[model samples]
Target: MTPPPAPAAAPDPAPGWLVPGALVLRLMLVAALAVALSGSVAAWLVTRASGQEAMRRMVSQQTDEVEVVARLLASKIEQSQKVLRTVAAGITPGMLESPSSLEWLLQQGLPAVQFFDTMQVARDNGELRLSLRAGQLEKAADLDPTERDALRRTLVDGKPLVSELITGRTGEARVMFTMPLHREDGTVMGVVAGALRLQSQSLLPPSMTLPARDDSQLIVFTRDGTILSHSDPTRVLGQVRDEVGLAPVYTRWQSQAQPVVGRGMTHVQSDHIVSMAGMPLPQWIVARVSQSQALLAPLRGAQREAWWLAVASMALCMLLAVALMGWMAQPLAQLTFKARQLLKTSTRQRPETEMHWPQAGGEVGDLVRVFQGLVQQGSLQQSRKDTVVGQFQAVLDSATVGIVITRHGMLEVVSHQACVMLGYTAQELQGRPSRTVYASDADYAQVGDRVRAEVAAHGAFDGDICFLRKDGTPVWARVQGRGVRPEEVHGGTVWILEDITAAREAQVQKSWGRMHDALTQLYNRAAFDERLGQLMTERSARQRAPALEEEGGEAQGDGVVLFLDLDHFTVVNDIAGHDAGDDVLRHVARLLVSHVRQIGWAARLGGDEFAVVLPGCALARGQAVAEQLRAAVRAWEPSYQGRSFTLGVSIGLVVLDASLQDVPSVLYAADMACYDAKRAGRNRVETRHARDVSVTSSGRMALGPV
Candidate 1:
């Protein structure tokens, strides 16, 4: 009747339910999302950059590793050269007049390893004078036109030459190292050559020719692109372009003109990483081809870690955001619930027991504030980027080795150690061409010719280099260089230099010590066996050759073995102590060496026992050498502590002929003869011509040659 009281004032329409709680929840969620996104993106960016740096270092290391392998292979090749040089140096004009003597000389100096299948000496007129194979002297084979030409070139060049690969009748690939024999005036009188079996473990290590991966391959080739060695035997002595993975690299390297001392890598293809190094000694190039995945394995793991870090940051932020929203909107949510309950009824209100209000403290900040944080975060990111760049430029600053960065040929950055090493201030070196540090123009040109190209292709270049300091002192450094970007060396290259002059000299000494005795300065037992065994094996193999039989070659052996025991060595050791014994032994070694100069190798077979291997010696000659040595020992009147001591030697000689089975039998027969000499009389000579012969109780030779 009162017109429904104006429709009950429409209950004031409930103020349209503003819903502040949901607004608070929405604002909190947005702020949380922004925070999570910013934090996650920042973490991801930081980690990704770090990951990229790590990848660069890892790839550089792999390239360095390949370079190391190349050097090791080069050392192995150098070993053969050293053996050949030993042979050439031991040649005398007197020995060359007698073909048998020269052949015996070759057998004595030949390497015992399976490195050389055949060794020979030829006159400058192309006459083959001496040929020894498998430890035995034999007739030289007729030289083909190609080999004859190579020999002529060797004589003309007056230098060592590594011949191109040759295929033997047995289908085996081999190479020849021709070392020129020089007179005092440096004339190339003749050539001493050793035939290299390409697959010989001594010439090429098993590790280099056998790759662990099927998709990978390693090869040794000449500057002309002729493959000298290969992981696959069938590919040895083939063309470089035949391998599918290496064709592009070969072409590119050829286009650039082959360098004799440089390293490089190629990745024109996506799947392969081809690294190569050229050796200075043999003019050979060592190339390693591997799958890209092998180099990128670390990069993938790093990227995954970055992604995980970003995801974890995002999840953590979202959890914090949900908690904030719940805490900040709890009171408002309750108030909204009560208001809706009241709206459902017609009654206005009894007084509520509790009141709730929304809190704004934990809610999202205003847009301006959010943007201000973003601006600061951007500045922080810039600062972080600068710090990262500085760290990169200063990496390994405290290391003793010098580190430098170069663009083109100019120095861009250098570690403190590099400044000290070059004897230049940082200000003096920056932006200067590295050419200033090289000892010679040739060295600088060599670096320019190969280092840049190699770094661009292979990522790294490593070798020993000589540099000139600011004070003009020459410095020998082992340098290892890698590109900042392997795909593009123009970006920059980093080099590490270590002083290695002392180490290099020490290495040479160490190598010498490996084969010589500390006390006698002569070949050790192992070295003696190596030389003696070569002679024995040469004889054995030649005896088995049908050609020798067909040619009516005599089966008589050319080597003579001698066994000598000091008659009164124990008296010296007991009366004057070991010092006198040592002196006497050294004197005896000198006499032995003098007697066999340029003809035989002498070794200390152990305590108080001495042996000699006389190549080209008959039984009569062997006996003469033994008597001379016995008389020399008997004449040695050594005085120790003002007391003169008398020393004598019992000598035994065994003619090492083709009839003997092996070195052991010859050595035992010689030993028995020496025992018989001692039992028969003091300071005398005894000779054994056959293994079947023995010493009777009366010290008389028995069981003569059948």
Candidate 2:
């Protein structure tokens, strides 16, 4: 019948390549990413700091430019104030009373002082009596209220005062420097003032020398945030706070006790630098407003270059990862192929010479060396296996005993003696079940169980067992064996079988001779002593017998010993020689055997003297057995050498019991009774019971029972 199909196995999971391949790739990528991220962050920090430094430098440079412009303007105002004071020292009340003389004095003095837009000498009522315009003398007019207040302050303090920025009649921003004119007696007289036009390019530094960018500006504003003049002409004269971007900066500058330098917003940048310095005169603030982005342009360029370099590094990492993957996989693939080929070659019966495989350096080279070692080891092992097998076979054949190796209860290898002993060729025994050599299933199972037990306890076995030869005759074999490993005898068991058939038969014959007589082939006297002693020992021990119980009650001892003496057996030896005497002894032995067969043990003590022991028998039964043996001997007729003679036996019987000390005592009692029977009549039988009063350790004769 076809076997049932096996259950389908679950599919194996897919080979796990992601971990090995992706691990290298991911490691490289992660390292590169970490480096890139760190580099980018570091570059950003460096660039940000550089940008701030650039801004600081720019602010410093711009502030210096604004300060230079303010100083120039302040110097011009101071020089005009000094010139007015000197002219005032010359002008007396007389010069003030004559407008013509005052005009002439102002024109001559103002012409000597540069940067004076207009020069005037005014009375205490703030009316300019005479003035110089563009270096020409003109009639003076009353000053406006703002100009009067500044002239009044100048007269009251008797010192020079710088006026707030004002618009000229021509729509230009200007500042006036005013001083009180004093009389020779130290009395305040009129005011001398000069106005400098700030809008005129000459009042400010040259545009080319300014550090401010196109998007930047330099402005001079009042403490109240009023615009005075700006580098950008369009923003000149406008309120500083009116420009929304500059409001906060203007407020901060106004509150500051010293020059303020910080970032602020402007039209160009929401956050730009505003550096403010307070001018000495008019308390005006000179501020340099610079765009932050414009100042950091160089830093940005450097940052862009850093980002491009990072991108290039990432591309290089990709190329290296690809190259490393191939470099790693190729050597392993070659090693795998070579290893497989080596395995295939190693399995063949006759392998070729050692393989020379491809090699690489480093760890791959070490692996190649290991593979070479393995191949060489395999070759050495093969050669060793061949030598070992040859040596094993030589050892097996040389052994005196037959050795057989069995696997799974089948003979795998058989020695020459084993084959010869079984009367079969080596091929016939190989692969055959070990049971095939057993005489019977019982013998096979019996030997197997015993051998297994021996092997389990000692790793070896030895015993005698019966086996069948090829001709179906049984042979006694002495077997010794051992297993290769515990509980794995089925894997391999080495057995040595020595045929002991002839030796066993000889042993049996030797044993038979030691206990039996050569003349009658009956048990000898020594055997009789042994048998009778054993029987008496059993009877004394009270061993019960079923037969004796069924027949009648057992005496204290239930064994019987009989002694028989041949009647007139000397007459045959005298007439027909010792050969005829041997014939008579043989006839008597057979007669005793026929009468007492299976009843008990019988043995010939010596020439013409014999004894029998009946176990579990009462005295009455032993007496009846002795009479039968006497009658059989009397009835026997022997004819030897054509001569006829009749022979009879004198018999004596004794019952074995507790009173008998041992076999020797029983024999003495029976021997004495036999002599009594011979004395009374040669062929008659006499009986003695074990409890007879005369029987004792010291005496042999017993007349009657107790």
Q: Against the true structure, whose TM-score is highest? A: 1
Worst 10 residues of 1 by lDDT: 361-370
Alpha-carbon shift of residue 222 in model 1 (angstroms): 3.2
Off by more than 4 A, model 2: 1-26, 92-94, 113-115, 123-129, 135-142, 168-172, 183-187, 201-213, 252-269, 294-302, 317-706
Q: For residues 1-706, what per-residue lDDT tens digits would candidate 2 score against the true structure?
A: 8666455444333333322233345565676676667666776787778766776677677667666666766676666667666666677788888987776666654344445767777787666687666777655443445555777788788888888876645665667778787776876888877777775554543462355457677777777777766666666667887764567766664576544332222222456767666666667667777667666777788878877886677567666766676566654555544544444444324334557666554434545654665687788999999999999989888888899988888988899888888888988888899898987776788788898788778888988878888999878889888776656656688888989999888888878989999999899877777776776666654545556655756343476788888898888989889998887888788877877776776788888888888887777788888888888888878877788888888888877666778776787778877888899978988877656536556665422211
Over 1-706, each residue of candidate 1 has an lDDT whose tens digit, in order, gives 3333222323234343344554676777788888777877787787778756764664576567667767886787678788778778888877777876776666654453235777777887778777656656755564444555667788888888877666756566667778898888877789887787677777664566654667677788877778877778767778988777788888887898866675745353577767777777667788777776666677778778877877887888788877766776666655555444444443433332222322333222223232343566666798899999778756657778998889877998888888888799888998998888987777798767677676556667887887889999877788898778777848888889998877777776877777776777777766776778888887777667868666865544477988878887888888899988888888888999999965687987777777899986777777777788888888879999889988888887888765566556666788888888999987888887774664333444322211
Best model number under lDDT? 1
Model 2 vs. true fold: TM:
0.39
TM-score of each: 0.41, 0.39
